[model samples]
Target: MEPDIATQNDSGQDSESGLSLRWSARLSLTTRILVVNVLAIALLAGGLFYLNNYRDRLTEERLTQARLQLTIVADALSSGDIANRDALVEQFASHLGARLRLYAPDGRKVIDSFELAEPTYQFVDPDAEPLRKDAARMLDKTIESVVFTTQIPNFSEPANDVAGAWSELETAERKSAAVSSVSYAPDRTPVIVAGKSLPDGAGSILLTANARDITRIVRAERASVLLVILVAATISILLSLFLARTIVRPIRKLAVAAVRVRMGRSDEIAIPRMPGRRDEIGQLSRALSDMSAALRHRIDATEAFAADVSHEIKNPLASLRSALEGLERVDDPDLQKQLLDVANDDVRRIDRLINDISDASRVDAELARAKFEPIDIGKMLEQLLAAREQRTSNLGVHIAFARPAKDVAKVMGDGGRLERVFGNLLDNAVSFSPEGGLVEILATPDGDEIVIHIADQGPGVAPDQREQVFQRFHSDRPDGEAFGKHSGLGLAIAKTIVEGHQGEIRILDRDGGESGACFEIRLPKAL
Candidate 1:
C-alpha cells in the first residue's frame, strides 16, 4: 500500500521535536535570568571603566601643568644671565599666571608676586545687577567685592603667614628635594603647588597655580557626564521594559498555559498567537499552542472511545440477559439446552468484548510509553506464519511467509507489539481465505523502511468501506463464520501499533484487482 503522509513524516518530525525539547530543557530559570541581565551589566561596567580612566587623565593633566611651572621658575633662579632677579621673577609670575615665591636658605623672601601686585581692584556683585542708579551710587563707597592682598611685605616670621608654602620650600631646600602637591591656600582657593630646590643651594623656588579653573572644568564635565548617564539609564529602562514585554512576558504566559494543560484544563486555556514575530519566543509560543491543540484532540478522541466502548459492551450484555430470562421460563429439555448454549455463547462473547475493549482503550497510552528494540521483520513474520500454520492445519488454511532478501528486514519497534500486529493481520487474512487457501506474508525492504504485505484469497473489501473497516466493532465477517467469533478489534489494534512504531498500515487491492484483501504495513528500518 502507498504510505500515509503523516505516518511517513513521523520519523523526521520526532528527531526535530527531540532537539527542540532538549534545548528547552537546558534553559533553566537561572540561565534565562543571566541571559536577560548580561547586556545591562556589561553596559554599566563599561561606563564605569571609561569614567575612571577619564578622571585619572584629568588629574594627571592638572599635575603636569603645575610641574612645568615649577621647573621653569627653578631653572630661572639658577640661571646667571638675568641681571635683575626681581624683574625676572615678576615676568615669570605674570606670564605663567601664577604666584611665585623665592626664599633664601634663611627663610628670607627675595621676591613675592602677591606683595608686588597693586592692591586695589573692582568686583561686581551679581545680586546688585538690578539695583537702581541712586542705590548703586550710595554703595560705591562700600566694600562691595574687592579685597586687598593679605601677604605683608618684608614681614618677620613669613613662615607663619604662609605656613604650607613655606614648609614645602624649606623641605625642598633642606632635603634638596622636588615636591608637587595639591592643597588649599589660607583664603580657601584651590592650589596646585610644585617646589624644587635651586642648584648650588641658591634657596628654593615655590610655584603655586590656582587649580580653580581645572577643578571647575572637571566639576562641569562630571555634571554633564552624570546627566548623560541619567539619560542613558532612562533609555535603557524603556528598552528593557519593551524587551520584557516581548520575551519575558510571553514566556511567562506560555508557562501558565503549560501549567493549565498539565492541570487538565487545556481545552479551556487560550494561547495568544504571535505569528508575526520571528524570534525564539515566537517559535516557543507556536510550539506550545500546537501542543495544546494536540492535547485537546487526544482528550476528545478518548471521550469518543469511551462512548463507543459503552455502546459495544451493552449489546452482549443485553443478549446474555435475554438468554438467561428465556432459560428460566422454557420447559422442554432440548429447548433448555439450546437456551443454555445461547447463554454460554453470550457470556463468552461479552468476555471477549470486554477484553478487546480494555486493550483498545489502553492502546494509545501504552504505545506512548512503549520502549522499542530492533527486531528482524523477516524472522518475526516467519515465526508468526509457522505458529499460525500449525494452529490452522485442521482448517486446511495456511499462512505462508516470504522475504525479499535474507537478513535485510530489520526494523525498530517493540518486538512483542510488532509480533502482535502481524499476528492479527495474518489471522484476519486466514479467516477471510477459502478452504485450503494460502495466506501469504511477505517482507521487503523499501528505501529506509521495511514493508510487510499480508494477502488473502477472499472476497475483497469494497472501496467505500475500506476506511470504515478499521473502526471499533465494525465488521464484515464471511457468511459461514460463526457469530461472536470475532471482536472486530484486530485490524484497529494493528493499525494503532503500526502507527505508534512510526509506520503506516493500509488495505490494498490484490494484484490485478482480483478477489481478496491485501494488508500492507511499512515500518522504519533499524539503524
Candidate 2:
C-alpha cells in the first residue's frame, strides 16, 4: 500500500528543510566575514616576497662596484713595476674591505693580499650564532625558498685557496673582461665576487666582498612588513567578529522565534523588537514582532468567532427540533398549523444565521483584496433611498436625504461594500421607526474626511447598550417586532466594512436633542 498522504507531505517537508540546512551550513556568515577581512591583509603580506628581488639588486650593485675597483687595481699594477704589485694589492684590499688575489697566465697564484697584510673581512659561521640570529637566518632562507624556489649555493674558499679554483677569474681571463658572481654565506648573508683580466695578459685580479648589509636591509624591511600585517590581521579579525555578532545574532534570534511561531508554539515565544537600533535589522525585528502579534490576535478572534457561531446556531436548531416533535404529536389542525409556522420561522432563522456567519467570516479576506475607487456618498445614499422606496412599502416611514454638494462627499472605498453599509443602516432605521416616522440622511465634508449621518425617529439606544448592539447575535429589537428577523450581525459587519475602508462608525444622539439614534460614519476623502 502507498504511504499515507500526511506521511508523504511530512517527508517532503523534511527533505526540503534538510536541503536548506545543508546549503546554509556550507558557509557561515562568520567565516565569510573573516575571509573577506583577512584577504586584505594577505594582499599586504605579499610585499614580503618582493624583498628577494630587492636583495638581488643590492648584491648585483655591490658586485659591479667590486669589478670596477678590481679593474682599477689591475690597471695600476700593470702600469707600475711588478715588485710593488703586492704592496699595492694589500693597500687596495684594505681600503675596499675585500680580499684580493693575483693569478698568473698559467693559473698560478702570484700575489695574495692576506699574506701581505691583515685580513680585510671574514664570513660569520652561522652554526656558532645565537638563537636570535638563527631565527633570522631561518626567516631569510624561508623567504628565498618561497620566492625563488631554488637555493643559492653556499660561499666557500677554493680547495687549497689557489687562483685556479676561482671560476670567475678564469671566465674574466677567457672573455678579457670583468665578470662577477654571488652566493650566500653560512649566516644567510650575500657574498659577492668579481674578476678582471690584467692589462696585456699579465694576469687576472679576483676581488671578494661579504655584502652582509644587503641581507640585513632586506630582512629588516621584511620584518617590518610582517609586523604590520600581523597587527592588521588581528584588528580585521576582531572587527569582523564584532560585525558578525551585531548582524548575525539578531537574525538568528528572529529565525528561532519564527520557527517557534511556525511550530504553533508562539504563545511561549516573545519575538524581540530591538527598538533602540535604527538599522534595517532593527526594522525587521519590529516588523516581525508586530506580525506575530497580529497573527496571534487573528487566531484568538477566529476561535471566539467559532464558539459564537456554534452557540448561535444551536438555539435555532433546538427550536426547529421542538417544533417538528410537537407537529408529530399534535392532532388538532390549529395546533399543527401553529407548530408548522414555528418550524418555518426556525428554519428561516437558521438560514439567515448561516448566511450572516458566512458573510462575517469572509468579510475580512474579501476587503483585504478589494480594489477601491472614489465613490460619492451623496449620490450613493440618494440612489439607495430611491431603491428602498421602490422595493419596500416602508409602512409610512419616510426617508429624506439632504444630499451634499457635488464632489463634497467623495471617498475611496469599494462601492458595493459601502452601499451595503448604508443599506443596512437605512433598513435598521426603517425597522425601528414608528409608522409615519421620518428617517433622515445627511452627507457633508469635514476636513479630509466625508461624514454621513443616518438619524431615525425611534426609541434611542441606551448608553450602556449602544456598544453591545453592534455585537453578533445581539437582538434588542423594538417592541412588537418579530424575534430573529435580524441576525444582529448587520451592525457588526457594518463596523467591519467601515474599518476596512479606513473609516469609523459610531452611535450618537441627534444634534437637536431629538429622541432618536444617530449613526455617524466618517470616511477619508479621496485625494
Candidate 3:
C-alpha cells in the first residue's frame, strides 16, 4: 500500500536535507559560537595588511620630491662658475638632509658633499640597536613576510664610491631627466636615491636620503592597531565562552533528561522547567516537561485499560463455561434448553464486551487525526431527535429538544464523533427515564461556548458516583435493567472525545429542583 502524504513528507525531509546540515550537526554549539565571534575580530585584524601599501605610497612620494629638488640644485650649479659648485652642493645637502654628489660629463667625481660639509644622516646598523628596536624590526619583517611585499635591493656603497658605481646617475645621464630608485638599509629602513642630469649636460647630481622616520611611523601605527585587536579578540573569546556556558549547559541537561525518558526511566527523571528564566529556552524546558508528564499518564492509562478488559472478559467466559458444563450433566429437555439459552446469552455478552472495548481503545487515536468543521449544534440536535423518534422503541419516554436559533450554537468539531457523543447521552437518558417520563436536551450559545444539557426524569446518580460514571467499564445501570445490555464505555468515550475537542463535560444536579441527573457539555464556538 502507498504511504500517506504525511508519512511521505516526513521521509522526504529526513533524506533530502543535504551535506551542509549533516556537516554542521557534527560540531558542538560551543565551537559554532567561538567560530562566529572569532571571525569578526579576524576581519578587523586585516587592517594590519593595508599598512604595507600605505608605507609604499609614502616612499614613492618622498622619492618624487627628492628627484625634483636635485634637478633644481643641479640647474643652479650649472648656471654658476665651477669655483662655487662645491659650496652650492654642500648647502643643498645640509638643507635637504641628504648626501649630495656632483660628477663630470665623463662620469668623473667632481665634488662630494661629505668632504665639504658635516654629514646630515647616517645608515643604522641593526645588530647594534636596543632590544625594543630589535623587536620593532622583527615585527616589520613579519608584516612584510605576511603581505609578500616586493623585494628591494639592500643599500651598499661600491668600493670606488664614484659616479661610475651609481646606477641612478647613469640612468639620469642617458635620459637627461630626473630618475629615482628605492632600497632598504640594514635596519629594514627605506633608502631613497634620486639623480638628475645637470642643465646643458654639466653633469648628473645624486641625492641619497635615509628615510628612517617613514619606517618608524608605519611600525608605530601597526603596533597600536595590533594592540587594539589583541584586546578586542581576548574579550570576544571570553564572551563567546561565557555565552556557550549559559546556553549549551542547560540544553545538555535537557538532552540527558530526554534520553532517560526515552529509555523508559521517566519515573526517575525530572525534566527541569527552569521557572526562573523567561526566555525561549525556558519555554522549551517547560514544554518538554509537560510532554513527559503526559506520556507517563498515557502509559498508566493503557496499563489500567488492559487490566479492566481482562477482568471483564473473564466473568462472561466463566459463565459460559459453567452453562456448557451443566448442559452435559442434565437429562431433562427443559433444563437443557435453558442451559443452551444461558450459553448463547453469555456468548453474546462477550461479543458485545469485545466490541465496546475496541471502540473505547480507538476513541483517542481517531479523534487525534479527525478533521473538524463548523457544526450547528441546534441543527444537529434537531436531526438527531427526529431520527431517534422514528427508530426508538421507548415510546413511553418522550424526548424534548429545546433547540436554539440557527447558527447561534455553532461549534467546530468532528460531526460524526459529536453525533455519537450525543447519541450515547440521549440513549443513556432514555434508558434511565420512567414510563411517560421526559428526557430534555437543550442547546444554547453562552458567549464563546455552545452549552448542551441532557437531563432525564429518573433515579438520579449520587453526587459521589458522578465522577466514577465517566471511567472505563463503569456500569451503574438502573434497577430492573437487563444485565450486560450496555457495555458502560459510552460515557467514557464521550468524555474522551469532548476533551480532545478542547471542550468540557460534567454531570450536575438537574436545575429547577428537578429529580434527575444533568449531563452538561460545553464546546468552544466555531469562531
**Model 2 has how many clashing residue pairs?**
0
- For candidate 1, what is the lDDT? 0.71
Which structure among the candidates has the greatest TM-score?
Answer: 3
In model 3, what lDDT does residue 382 have?
A: 90
Clashes of each: 0, 0, 0
Give the runs in model 3 whose Cα sits over 4 Å from its true position. 1-23, 79-84, 130-139, 393-395
Q: Best by lDDT, which number?
A: 3
- Candidate 2: where are CA atoms >4 Å away? 1-25, 63-84, 116-120, 132-138, 141-151, 160-164, 266-268, 393-396, 405-408, 464-466
Each model's Cα RMSD = 10.8, 4.5, 3.8
Task: Please provide, for model 1 over 142-211, each residue's C-alpha lDDT reduced to its tens digit, 9 standing for 90 to 100.
Answer: 2112222222122122445442446666566666666666654332224666777788766667776765
Question: Relative to the true structure, how large is the alpha-carbon lDDT of every model?
Answer: 0.71, 0.86, 0.88
Over 4 Å off in model 1, which ranges? 1-68, 71-75, 78-83, 103-110, 118-165, 184-190, 196-205, 216-235, 259-279, 398-400
Candidate 1 vs candidate 3, lDDT winner: 3
Please provide TM-scores, in order, for all candidate models, with all chains considered together: 0.75, 0.85, 0.92
Under the 3 Å rule for N, CA and C atoms, how many clashes does model 1 have?
Answer: 0
Order the candidate numbers by lDDT, best to worst: 3, 2, 1
